[model samples]
Target: MPAPNPACASNKTEPSMLADSIDALLPQTQCRKCGFNGCLPYAEAIARGEADIDRCPPGGDAGIAKLAELLGIAAKPLNPAYGIERPRLLAIIDEDACIGCTKCLPPCPTDAILGASKHMHTIIADLCTGCELCIAPCPVACIAMVPAPNLTWTETDADRARLRHLAKQQRLTKLEAEKAERLQRQKQLLSKAKSAKNQD
Candidate 1:
């Protein structure tokens, strides 16, 4: 789907500007459960009035209530299309079974999984948003999601995760740009070589 216009909101603040406030209230798991690429995109959709606050399974009913109040709309039940709300889940890697293919690393929004290729991978408990993003990519199927009863997600945690997610996005964008530049230079050199050979 085309992204909502960043300026679509009619509030005094543009949707892009209003996104910050909406994002602040989000769980910041960077999980795509809400049908957006990340929490910020979902917030932007909400700001643009394109997405409902009830779509966040991670945010649960309370989160919907908060959004409802913020938007001055009546609170509604969490939307089942996005999945039902549940307790926070933490991803655990089975060390013995972990193949260390590094496939799981890229999916983690927080970069919580740490390991080199061909080595045992481990998840940093505190950094893990329990987004369950790492589980699907594991080639060994060794990753498991378990309820995190002792850990409570808070505003501070959300803020830190948000910053990390943004940083990761920047890093990925830079890498893609560099890769494109390298490819362009390679193509130019090949073209030059082909021309030189033809002339000779």
Candidate 2:
């Protein structure tokens, strides 16, 4: 797991009090089954009245009841459009089948899949949030989810996963910024070269 962020672990925000409370109740799967980026984004949307509270399939009917109680609204059934709640599943990679394509690495919010191009990949069982986002990207179909009846998402597990997800998001954002900066410099250098050539 990555470093801890109290804001993410506690789901307490200094701003957007309502959203923070809403997020605190969410399972923090970071699964994106809610159709938003993650639990926090979904909570923010709910705070803005832009989304329904029933989209969290990982949270199931019990989760919906908690949200409804929090919002003082009537509890509704889990929205089938998102997914049906079932036993928690953990992703496992078949090493023999994995082509080392490194396709599934980017989609994992928790950074659970570890691998390099032309090398086999593996899942970090404790770190994986079981988001299922990694399954579709595997060209070789080496990734699959198994029911983890013994490993339920306790608060600690969710907190750890949330921290990893937050850290990964931060890293990706920084890398994107660096890429954009490099591109800008390349553009400037090319323009300067054109001006210099024209003067000659």
What do the candidate models score in CA lDDT, each in turn?
0.86, 0.84
Clashing pairs in 1: none
lDDT assessment of candidate 2: 0.84
Collision count for each candidate, in order: 0, 0
List, residue by residue over 39-120, the lDDT tens digit for candidate 1.
9999988887788788888889899888777766678898798898988889889999988899998999988889999999
| Model 2 TM-score, all chains together | 0.89
**Candidate 1 — worst ten consecutive residues by lDDT sum?**
1-10
User: lDDT value for candidate 1?
Assistant: 0.86
Give lDDT tens digits, candidate 2, residues 1-200. 21222233333344378787888888888889888999999888777666887899988898899888777677889889899999889999999999999999999998999999999999988888789999988898899999875667887887887788889999999999999999999999999999999999
